[model samples]
Target: MATSEQMEAYSQFWSLTLGFAAPFALKAAVKLDIFNIVSKFSSEQGATLDEIIQELRIKHDADSIQAERLFRLLRFLVFKKVLALNGARYGLTPMSRLLVSHGSSSDVFVGGILSFCTSEVTQRSWQHVDAAIKRPGDSNAFVEAHGMEPQDYVAAHPEFWKVIEDFRLSISTATSATITRVYDGFKSVKRLVDVGGDTGSFLAQIVRLYPHIQAVNFDLPRVIANAPAYPGVENVPGDAMDFVPPGDGIFLKSFLHMFADADAAKIVKNCHSALESDGKIIICDMVMDEGKELHLQLDMMFLSGSQRYQRTKAGWKNLLESCGFGSVRFFEADPFSITEAIKN
Candidate 1:
C-alpha cells in the first residue's frame, strides 16, 4: 500500500528522532562495566549472559526475568555494533574496546565522556539550549541551568571533577599520540611550554619523544599542585590568561576552543609575548570543515554549554595573524587538527 521510497523516508525520520536511544544505551553499558567485564575473555570465547550477570553481581528472586531484561539490553547493544554476539556469548566490539578502562592513567576510554554527557546535570543543560540560542551576549546553557559556570560546578561536585578529569586525560592521550606521529615542528624546539596541560600527561609524551627539549607543564596552581613529577617536564603553576611561561615552542591543545575569539586572541597574544625570536606556537583544536558531522556537533555543544565554538581555517588564520604570528600551517589529525605559527 506504501511506496518503498516513502517508507524509507519515514524510517529515516523515526531513526533521527529517536537517535538518543543509541547513546543512552551506550551510557548504560559503560555504567554497568559491561565492556570491561567482557574484555577479560577472548572474542572467540566471549562471555555468556549468565557470566556477565554474575560479574555484574545482579541478584533477584526472579532470576529469569532479570536475565531476560539484561539480555534484551545486550541484544540492543549488539544491534548497535557496540557489542558482538557469537552464538550465545557476547563479546566486546572495537567500539566497545574504547569504552573499557584498563586501569591505566594513559589509556583512552570513551566511558568518561559518555558518563559525563549523559549525567543529569548535562541533560538538564541541554533543555536550556534554546534559551542559550535566543539569549543575548555569550549566554551559556549550562550556567543558566545550574546557576554556575562549568568549572565552578565541577569544583563544587568532586564526582563531576573526576569525570571531567578522566575525559580530559583520555582526549589528551589520543591527541598526544597523533601529534608526535604527524607533526615534526617540535624537532627544532629547545624549550616547550604546554598551556593548560593537565598533570603534564601530554607534555610527558612529547618530552619522551624528544628528550633534548625542556618541557614546562603550565596550568593553574590547583592543577599543578596535583601533578606528579615527570622526567624532563617541569610543572609550573600559572594562568594562561594572566601569564604563560617563556618558551621557544608553546603548545595549546584543546584549549582555544574553550573561549570566544577575543579571549582566545588574548591567550595567543600572551603566548606570542612569551616566545623567543622566531619561536613557534602550536595549537590543537577542531577546525570545522564542511560536511564533517562530528565537528558540527561539537560546535553545537560548545554553543550550548559555553561561549566557545570550533574555528574554521579562515578564522584560525585571522586569530593567529592578529596575534603577531606568521607562516601558519594546518595539519589533519583525528579528533583534533594541528595548527602551527611562528613569531614574526
Candidate 2:
C-alpha cells in the first residue's frame, strides 16, 4: 500500500491537472457576461431562469435542456464564489463588482483581460505548449503554433479576429470606469500622456473629468485613427516600445507584461527619458505581491501571452530602479496596482 505521503503527492498532481477546469468555467462566465447579467438582475433580488432569459434577450425556452445546463453551471460559479446567488435571484459578490459593475464606467482592464484570456482561440494556442517544450523553441506555444506573433496571427486570421473583437466588446464598458477611478490622479498632474492608449477611450474620459489637465493620446497610427478628439488633448501615433510622449506624467493602461523583461525595459527607459528628471509614470497592471490564489492562477493562465506572470511591487520597483528611474511608490487603485516612478 502507498503511504500517506505518496497519496498527498498525487493529490498535488491532480490539483494541478484540474487547473484546466478553472479556465473552462471562465469561458462560460465570459460568454454569459454572468457577472454583468447577475448585477442587472434587479439589484434588490436575485434572478430566476425566466428573468435571465428575458434580461439577455435570448431565444432559449425556459424548460430547454440548454437552459437547465446553463443554470447548473451558474450554480457551480456561485459555489466557487465567482457568482453570488440568493434564493431565486443572483447578484454580484465583492470580487464580481471589480468586473461587471465598474463603479460608473467601463474598466476594460477587467473586461479585456478576462475575455481575451478565456477565449477559444487563445485556448487553442496553449495546447501546443508541450510541442514547444520538446523542440527547444523560442516561444511557449502561441508563436510556435501560428508561426507568427500574437497580433500578426490575429490580423491574418479572421476566425481568431472575431473572438478578439468580441472580447474587446465584452470589456468595452470598463475603459471609462478606469478613467473615472483615476481622474483625481490625472487632475493633479499638469501634462499626462497615455501610452498605448487604444482608441483614446480612456484619454477622452480624463478630458471629460478634468478639463484643466492637458492630455496626450499615444499609440500606433492604426489604433489612433478612431480616437475621438478631446480639447487640450493631442493624439500622437507612435510606438511606446521606442518612445513616449514628453509629459509630466505618463499613463500605461494594461500594457506591461505583454513583453518579456528586456522589451519592458526598453519602453520603461523611454518613459524615464520623456519625463522631467522628477516626473512620474503611472502603470496600470497587476501587482503580483498583492495577488490572491485566484490571481496567481490567472498569472499562470496567461503564460501564452508573454510567458510572464504579474510582477510583485518589489520586483517592479527593482525593475524601475534598474531602468534608470528611482523613487517608486506602489498604490492600490482598487482593481489594479497603480505604481509610480520618478525620473532620475
Candidate 3:
C-alpha cells in the first residue's frame, strides 16, 4: 500500500490537471454575465440559486438536473473564491467584479481577456508549443499553427489585436499608480510623448497629474484615429517605426519587450531622432534577471527566446548608449523596471 505522503502528492498532481478547466469555467461565467446579474439583483443576503437561474434565462426543471449543473459551476466558482456562498445563494467577490463592464476594473475588460484567451485560434496555437520548440530556428508556435507570423496573424485578425490592446491597457492600469507615485522626472518636461500609447490612458493619467506638461498620445494611425478624446493630451497618428512626435520626454511603457533586438533597436533609434539634444527617454519595461523565475516566465510568454530579447540592466545601458544616449539609469518597479536615459 502507498504511504499517506505519497498518496497526497499524487492527489496534488491530479488536482493540477483540473486547473486547465478553470479558465473555461471562468470564461463561461463571464459570457453568462453572472457578475452583473448578481451585482444588480442580489440583496445583502445574496442571490439564491433560483434567482440566479431566472436571471440567466435558465428554467428551473422538475428534475433539477440543468439547475444542478449551473449550481455546480457556481459552487466551484465559490470554491475558487470568485463568488461568495451564503447558504444556497451566490454573491460577487472582488475578483469576479473585475469582469463586470461598469466596475472599478471596467476599463481592463477582464471578460474580454478571458474570451480571447479561450478562443479557438489562441488555444490552438498553445497546442503547437512543442512543435515550435523542436523547430531549428526562430519558430513561433503561433506561426507554426496559423501559417503566419504573430504580427501578421494579429493583423489579419482584428479581434486578436483588440484582445492584445486590452491586455496592454490592463497592465498599464495596474502599473500606473506606482509609476506616478515614484517617478519624479515628469515635472520638468515641457512636452511628453507616449509612443504606442493605446486609448491614451497613460497619457491621460500623466496630464491629469501634471497639468503643466503638454502630453501627446502617439500610436499607429488606426489606433490614434479611434482614440477617445483625453483632456490636455493631443492624439497623434503615426508609426513608432517610421517617426515619433517630437517631445522633451518620450515614454514607452511595456512596449519594447515584444520585439527582438533588431526591431527594438530600430524603435530606440527613432526615439533618439525624435528627441532634442536635451530630451530624455524613459522606458518602463521588464529588465530580466537570470535568476528571477517569474520575470523569465513572463518574458517567455510574451516572446520566444525572451532570454535574448528581454534586456538585463547592463544590456539596457548598452542598447541606450549605442542609440546615442549619453547616460542610462535603472530603477526597480514592480513587474517592470524604469530605465531612464538622457541625450548629451
Cα RMSD to native, each candidate? 2.8, 4.2, 4.0
- Give the Cα-based TM-score of candidate 2 against the true structure: 0.77
TM-score for each predicted model, relative to the true structure: 0.90, 0.77, 0.80
Positional deviation of 187 in candidate 2, in angstroms? 2.7
How many residue pairs clash (N, CA or C atoms closer than 3 angstroms) in each of the candidate models, in the order given?
0, 11, 0
TM-score for predicted model 1 compared with the true structure = 0.90
**Top TM-score model:** 1
**Model 3 off-target regions past 4 Å?**
1-9, 41-44, 58-65, 86-89, 103-108, 159-162, 172-178, 181-185, 225-229, 289-297, 303-308, 312-314, 321-337
In lDDT terms, which candidate is top?
A: 1
Q: Against the hidden true structure, what lDDT does model 3 obtain?
A: 0.79
**Model 2 ranges with Cα > 4 A deviation:** 1-15, 29-41, 49-58, 61-68, 88-112, 133-137, 165-184, 226-232, 260-262, 290-295, 307-311, 333-335
Error of 1 at 93 (Å): 2.4
| Candidate 3: clashing pairs of residues | none
Query: Can you list the residue pairs that collide in candidate 1?
Result: none
lDDT of 3 by residue, 95-142 (tens): 887777764534444565566567787778767777777887877777
